[model samples]
Target: MDAAEALTLLMSPQGRVDPYPTYERLREHGPVVQALPGLYVVTGYAEADELLRDPRLGVLDDALRDQVWPNWRESPAVSSIARSMLRTNPPDHSRMRRLAAGAFSPRRIAGMRDVVRAQAEELLDGMRDRAGDGAPVDVLADFAYPLPVGVICALLGVPATDRPLFRRWAGDLTGVLEPEITVEELAVADAGAAELRAYFAELVAARRRTPADDLTTALVQVHDTDGERLTGDELLANLVVLLVAGFETTTNLLGNGLVVLLRHPGAAAALRADPGLAPAYVEELLRYDSPVQLTTRTTTAPVRCGGLDLPAGSTALLLLGAANRDPRRFPDPQRFDPTRDQAHPLSFGAGPHYCLGAGLARLEAQLAFPLLLRRLPELALAGTPRHRTRLTLRGYQTLPVTLGTPAVADRGTPAGAHPGTP
Candidate 1:
């Protein structure tokens, strides 16, 4: 397929289901191909990595959006995302990112390791309890989904009881991240954004009233030595961004990681044997099936990329999934080898706009995966797994699996022992 066709196919559901072949085609044509007028798609790893870090390229924020799509601000969902640090550039991006970094410190994220383990164990215990029913459990709902949501909620100081609310709102809001979204989806996302804003506003006020040892409280009170900090609106917008971003991508990572593990029995067995290998395993999983497939950036000045000269005001769609699998950067790129000694994947992105929650996401996955393998030793697919129909976010919507009875500690115990047997 040509560049245009390949780009079009990526927007189609079928292509979303499997975009690798199209990516290969795009890569064969060139590392960066002009997919359409004023639009380029980057398919190679080195090129994408360099372009992502290029200062001349930046998120299409309000000013750029106004020039490209006049009615962009009409959609609350779109506007919400546009205002986030993900879409801002330079001064605004720097300010907001610094504030967020202050609150999401490494020490804070490091402390969540134990919390991640406990939550993982708790979810697996629930899955184990249901194993006796001879019914398939959805790994997405029972484990992958809850683990990240729970961790993010705790980090944000949101009540665990309100997780269902966040899930509903986040589910609706993420539709805006797609390459193309329907009007109905836009309406749903808009409404969800309004509700989320109101909800977080109240929560922020509560945190201000009663300070707690949580990120929200810290964010609410954070300030630079020069008295620079997030404005009220910036605070609200970023809080929403943090809550949604904090879980959405990580949720996808957990689901996709589990699917990869289940499909690779040897790798899973290795992980089960040596839980310490989880950090490496998670890295491979991120490279193999990134939670986010594509991210867009706009050119602020004329630049040369992928052996082509592009003028200012151009848009580039960095096909991160394709780049991650690019053969030039990854030897045997398609192989799922945890032991592969390779540079970091562009999964969490690169440069100034790199994911603020990358460390937390990694910690969650590193801890969750090993715990999952230990808790669900005989976990195997019970039915065909289904992927979410999202071009930007790639992950399983439903991962049906049966947790076979856990082996007994006694060596003499017969195989296929009753699931409930001690």
Candidate 2:
């Protein structure tokens, strides 16, 4: 397939199902290609790395959107998120990120290890109860989904009762980030964003009235020596973004990690036997099949990228999934090896906007995987796994498995199973 054709297919359903081959084709032409007028696609490892850290490139902020897609803010979901650090440029992004970073201190992250272990054990217990008598249970529905959700909610001080509601809102709201979205999807996303805005407004107000020992309360009080900090709107928008971002990526990681472990019995055995091996295993999973496939950036000025001197006003689609597997950067990319001393994956991205929850996401997976293997020896795929339709934010929609260790499961051969490598 040619570069343009491969790029087109990457956004198609078939491509979303498995884009690695398409990425190979796209990378063949070069690291970067002008997919269309005003749009460039970057698939090469070196080029993607250069562009991510390039100060000339930035997210599609409000001013940039107005100049390009003027009606972009017509959708409430779009407008609301655009106000947050995720979509804003330097000054605003730096200010908000500083406040949020304080809440995500190294000490705080280190302390979450115990919390993650507890949550993972609790979810596994629930999964075992549901899968009693050898009945099948969806890892996505029972374990993978709730584990990260519960962790993020606990950090944010969100009530347990309100935890279930986030799944629907996050699903609806996150779709707006995709390049392709129908009117129906956009409507749902708008409603979700509105609901989130209202909910956080009250929650933040509540925190002000009665402070708590949680991330939200920490953010509410965090400030610089000059007393500069997140404004009310920034606080609301960021809180909503944090909840959605925190869980979605980790959920995908857990679901994807589980399948790979099931497929590669050697790796699974190693991880199960040596708990210390989890850090490498989880990092390798991020490279092999990244939860976040792509991210976009627009040029603040004429910038040299992908062996081309593109003009200002150009937008580049950084194919991070492809870059992670680049042959030059990683030899034998397709084969998943936890022991391969390899470069870091662009899965959490790079530069100033690197994922804020990246540490926590990694922590969640590293703790959850070994427990999953040990706690449920019989856990094996019960049926063909299904992935979510959305391509931009990829993950399992459902992963059915039986708790009664299917015959020969230890050898990576289980009932109703497919190849473990995604």
Candidate 3:
């Protein structure tokens, strides 16, 4: 199939289940292929990896913004979004990333190691308390989703009591984040955005009145600085992006990782036997099937990829899912081998805009996986798992699992103690 044909499949509901084959076809055709007028998709590991680090490719483009948010062409709020880190280029992107990066540095995230593990255990404990001898538990609902949500809540200083509300908002935002959706879904997304903005506005007010020692508190302090901080709208938009992106991606990582282990009983047994294997398993899971399937970028100048000349101002959607599986980069691309010697895939992205929350994300996965498996050794799929209707973020929507009745260890140490202990 041609690039256009593959893109059509991507936009269709059927493609949501499995975009890998289509991505492979696109890669075979060429590294760069136009999806539509002014829209191109790149599926090669080398090309996508290079473009992510290129100085010429700009995220903030008037032409692309016109295409993406046509309704907000004349609105200042859209302009604020245009100025945010995810949408900007060069110095602005650098600045925004730097500010967010400080709070998410390896050192800072290291401090949260215990917090993440504790949150995971707490969430799993809740599920166990509810589950009978062989009761079915949704891994997504009972464990994956809530674990990361709690960690992010603690990270951003959001009240844990408001988790249910945040969960709803995250769902609505994820729907719109998908490249293809019906007009009604788009309207729902707009409404969801409005609701999020309103909620953040109030939350910011509360934080301003009484500052706490949390990331959100620090962000509000940034605003108080002499025009060096993100604006109110920028804060809300980025916060929404951070919360949604943070929870959605990690939740999928945990879910997809377990799915991989379950499918390969050998690796599952190995992990259960040796908790230390969890980190390596996490890396393998990212390589085998990443949560972030693709991302979009645009060229500021004409560039040749796969013998094709893509003109300036054209869209480029990098298929991270395909590139991670590229035969050139990864031998035996289709297999889920936890012992593969390849470097971890570009799941957290690369270059100037590489994910800021990567450390925290990895910590969450490393800690959550083994603890989960150890706690529920008899966990198994209860039904045919169904994935969320999202192409960009790939994960199960409902992963029904029959978990073993977990017996708690007497006087368990907190989750963070393991990493810190000598």
Candidate 4:
């Protein structure tokens, strides 16, 4: 397929269903294909890997963002993302990244282990009740979505009752990240961003009066205690970004991982038998069906890559999903093998901008998969799963599953569940 034709398919609903074919078609044009006069797409593993860490290929900083969308500040969602480290570069990015990284310290994430287990158990209890009598339940909505939400909320010290508010707000706010968003989508994002800002502002105030051990409180302390380091706007925007980032991609990871496990019954069974294999299994899942697919970088200076020479100020669209499955990187790239060695996928991206929540996502999945397999002995795909019609983040919209209870003693008293759940 021609470059234009391949891009057209990639942007269409058909590509949303299976964009791998289109990625391959684009790859045929070479590692880097010029889509337009100044726009290029990189689909090769080596090229993408090299470019992701190249500082010369940078993101649209604040000045450029203002130029692209002059009235962006009018939309809370766009403005929030524009201000956060998500879009910043260089000296600014370095400081913001340092503070954010401190908040998600290794000790903090490790401490959440017990909390994650408890939350997973509670969610599983609810899932079991909903699937009583062998009734089918939508895993995507019932389990996958709520599990991450619960985990992230617990870390942020958000109360259980207020948890539901994030579901709608996160969806509305995150739509702006898509490659093609409609006018209506932007409006929803604006409203969501506004509400999030207000909510976090109040929460930040509450934390100031009485400090807590949560991530939000930690951020509030930093912002107020050291005004020169983090501004009020940066604090609010980071909070909003954290709440969304904490769970959005993870929801996809859990949903997609379950489907992969089910398809390979042996892998599922092996996991049920021995949960120790979770680390490797989770890595393969990230490689097999990545939660995120693509990202972009702009040229800061004239550079040559992937056998192409381009002028400065050009946009390079990095095809992460394609690079993950590139034959040069992984032998038999299409197959799902948990046993595969050194399977380093760009699913979470690379370089200084690597996903902040990647470690947490892996921890959640590693814990989740084992518990899921053991609890639902008769668990199986009960209906056809539908993929979300978005290419940036790939996952299911609804995953119907059956949870039948056999009289097997092994299914008794799963670790995460409370009393009388079995």
Q: Which stretches of candidate 1 lie over 4 Å from their true place?
A: 222-228, 407-422
**Each candidate: what lDDT?**
0.83, 0.83, 0.76, 0.83
Query: Candidate 4 residues 257-351, lDDT tens each?
Result: 89989999998887777777788898889888888888889998988998999689898888888988888888998999988896888988999
Root-mean-square deviation of each candidate, in angstroms?
4.8, 5.3, 2.8, 3.5
Q: Model 2 over residues 1-422: C-alpha lDDT tens digits?
A: 77678878988889888888889888888888887888888888889888889999999987878976789767768987897889987988988887778556777878777777777777777777777677888898788889899988988999989988888888889999887788898999999998998998888788889999888888777621233567666777888999999898898999988998999988898776666677889999999989999999999899987679778989999989999998888999999989899559999999989999898888888778877876676578877898888777888888999887422212222223332211
Ranking by lDDT: 4, 2, 1, 3
Residue 92, model 2: lDDT of 85
Question: Clashes in candidate 3: how many?
Answer: 1
Residue lDDT tens for model 3, 1-422: 77788888877778878888788778777776777888878887888898888776767566667776676544333443454676777676776676677778888888887677677778887888778766788888888888888888787888988877776666765675566667777666666666766777788889999999887778777877745557665677777677777798998998888888878888888776666666778888888889998877788898777667778887778889888888888888899887888456888888887887777778888887777777877778887899877888899878998887664541244343453421
TM-score of each: 0.93, 0.92, 0.93, 0.94
The pairs that clash in candidate 2 are: 378-405
* Candidate 3 stretches greater than 4 Å from native: 60-63, 67-69, 73-83, 407-422
lDDT of 2: 0.83
With a 3 Å backbone cut-off (N, CA, C), the pairs that clash in candidate 3 are 114-416
lDDT-better candidate, 1 vs 3: 1
> Distance from true position, residue 421, model 4, in Å?
24
